[model samples]
Target chain A: MTANWAAVLGSCAIAYAIKLSGHLVPHRVLQRPLVRASAALFPVALLSALMAMQTLTTKGAIEVDARIPAMAAAALALRARWPFIAVVAVAAVVAAGVRALGWMS
Target chain B: MTTKPRSVIIRDAISIGIAVGAYAISFGALGTTSGLTVLQTQLLSLLLFSGASQFAVVSIVGAGGNPASAWASSALLGMRNGLYGLRLAPLLGASGWRKPFAAHLTIDESTAMALANDDPADSSHRGARTGFWATGLSVFVFWNTATLLGAVAGSHISDPRVFGLDAAIPAGFAALVAPRLTTSLTRGLALVCAVVAVAVTPSVRPGVPVLIAALIALTTAMKFGEPIPPTTEDVSS
Candidate 1:
């Protein structure tokens, strides 16, 4: 893929602009219930979508591989309240092991 | 405000700062394996500093998607930063040149750190200001340094699947989001979105499916103003 400077610069500007504008926005606007609720729920949805996009998509196809089990291990460890580093370490080991077994490659 | 020693607060801040910094190493590795140049990934970490947005952009671009859509998705995920900025403005009390810099540093970890420092006993004065600046600045330093190491390592290791680094990004996302599934409603909503996103992935462009799944949030938002506590019955019920 081509390095699209425009998109990079545009997105960075938009992100920065959004932050700066948020400060300038009247407290009245922010105090609205709808604004508060939406902001709160937005990340809950976005991050879930991102987890899906990363885990399920591979080489232009939707295929489950080592990432699936690895993530399951991560979920389990997270449920157990493992520190963030341990959670990552468990996931990497599981995924690498699954790959080594030539299960999905 | 409860008279906790300043050393305790500093200890917590340094630990958090280190934790977030170590996490950035994976971003650097994932960024490069996904086809970003070392410079590009480094700058994304250094400038954007928002984990999800950076990951989303590189994920899309690495998957052969257009930059516009990538940017759009990244921008969407980062809109929360605007909300964060609103909350942090008065707390930081930055003026003139420092305003933009403070804005840049407003993120999940920093916000969480500062907000946690709110000791109700001393409502007028708490360690939030200190927590915010300390966490943000420390994260900045550690994150950049770790990124350099990860990117350099990423370059040396081709076929990232060899080390299962391919799985690192998604696993990291799952771990990050897991704690927020405190309520059954959030758990259920996230589960549905994940299922829906995966179902649509084969049929759509790399990023489009995820954006479409976000439409699910709108429906839930309309139906319920707030997530009911886990022990309660469904809001509709």
Candidate 2:
């Protein structure tokens, strides 16, 4: 097989393995206090990290761009009790508006 | 918090699906430009199924990086899914033939949706399961469909970024987690982790910052976070 194909298969194998490993953890281990607490907080951290990565960084570098205002707008929408779709739509609109102004590429 | 209605979970899942799926269009366009065949790109979307890792491989290959490097970077980025698995395994509790399918569908959005809708008062896993399956299937269908569209159309399609679709993922994520950030502990930990993630991103590899942030949150919670109350506390307030 070609290198590209090799990479593709290798990636699939590795990704699947990693995912399966988690499900294999014993139920007893999962019930530990530390583990349970960490699991509870994991989503908060991961989501926050994800938001930072998506909004604040570009290809491993920190860059201020349209996504910043877009995130701010999203926060505002959520604060105002806008529905989930509306919050996402507001972010997109703010981002599109920012980019259309030729301010952030 | 009460168990969110099934419709609410579906709504959250579909919104997230649409946002993430919209991003897939760009992924498809990028995949072909990176010299992979349309078929190859679709295979990645279908099988590999993780967004950041797929993007890592495509971009690295597009930059003339060797296969070893591409695999390494993508593998590193995918490790978070394993961490996600650790959390989701107990929550999902899939057994028999369903195990592999559940593992395959494990990703950021599904995990977040599952946990977000989880009823702290109960461990029935009912709502969490709906969130997981609905979000997983919704994103899979939309993402793959959009990938095909972007791949076949190629440069003829306008950039998804131009419409600011890129913001949708982060926005959707923020909305999912917002309701749970009521307590000072959760809020403070989230803020600190976000800062640490941003602080470390430029210095680390693509997915490492998030890992680091998760580690920090986990350790901090273990060290100083209050013990879980036996009964559900009204944390929403």
Candidate 3:
């Protein structure tokens, strides 16, 4: 694959722009109730959208497969209050195991 | 300046190390798979170290997109860290060389972990030092090492996705988000954001949807008067 230097530079610039814009906003504005609320809630929206994208999509199509088992494993791990590593391991193993068993082909 | 106990700092560092290391492997693998030279991959990790941004860059490059597009995509994703840095600035009050290092390491996981321990009454400086050093060192070392490994072994692997490797992004986010569920408002906001993000993802760019979700959650929080708790400071080490 050919590396596109222009694209790389552009992407970097855009990323920095987003960050700089946030910083450019005056400190007082940041303390405004609207801004504070958005900051507080932003993580939730970001993570949720992210989680859905990963768990719901299959090769660009909407179809649930091994991810279901993985999510299940994750839930169990959460219930057990396991460490993050343990939770991921459990989910991956369960998902892979189920696939191996032809349960999620 | 009162220094935090070395043990606490070290433990936090180790956790950061493990998390960054594992994620770096994916970054390296993606870099090489997407045609990045080993040097390029390592540089990306060393300099950028932000997974989503790195992923966006490589994925765009892999798809034969223009370098400008690739950079734009990665930059969009990297914007969040700036917000993280702003939030942490007051807490860290870092100056000199520490400022740059802390800024670089200001990712989701580190921010959450650092802020999770909310004890405004205790030593704020100690908390900042522990969080900054732990996260900065961990991401610096582990991310670089893991990326190198991935670059070396990247070509040999048949399918990293088969083992649910792609899930790392979501899993990582989950790790960050799950720990922050201290109140009903936060939980509900998280749920709404996730759902809305997923719904909007296909219609927009990968990172943009998440940003929108963030905005939605932010607005909702404002409307509801939800109390934003300080970071959790008391998780057992």
Going through the candidates in order, their DockQ values are 0.54, 0.45, 0.40
lDDT tens digits, residues B1-237, model 3?
A: 344566876687787677657767766766676666777777777666666677656654653445654554455446556666667777776778766566666666667656654357665556655766676677678878988997888766666556654454455456646766778878887777667756665565444555566567656766786466333332333
Off by over 4 Å in 1: A1-7, B2-7, B119-126, B228-237
> Each model's C-alpha lDDT?
0.73, 0.73, 0.62
- Residues A56-77, model 3: lDDT tens digits: 7543345677877787778767
**Candidate 1: tens digits of C-alpha lDDT, residues B97-189:** 988888888777777776667565664435777777777887888888888888878878878877877677777778666766777878888
Ranked by TM-score, the better of candidates 2 and 3 is 3
Candidate 2's C-alpha runs over 4 A off are A1-15, A18-25, A59-61, A80-86, A102-105, B1-45, B48-99, B102-161, B179-182, B202-206, B225-237
RMSD, candidate 1, Å: 4.5
Q: Candidate 1 DockQ score? A: 0.54
The local lDDT score (0 to 100) that residue B115 gets in candidate 3 is 67
Residue A91's lDDT within candidate 1 is 83
Candidate order by decreasing DockQ: 1, 2, 3
- Candidate 2's TM-score: 0.59
Ranking by TM-score: 1, 3, 2
- CAPRI-style docking class of model 2 based on DockQ: acceptable
* Candidate 3 overall lDDT versus native: 0.62
DockQ of prediction 2:
0.45
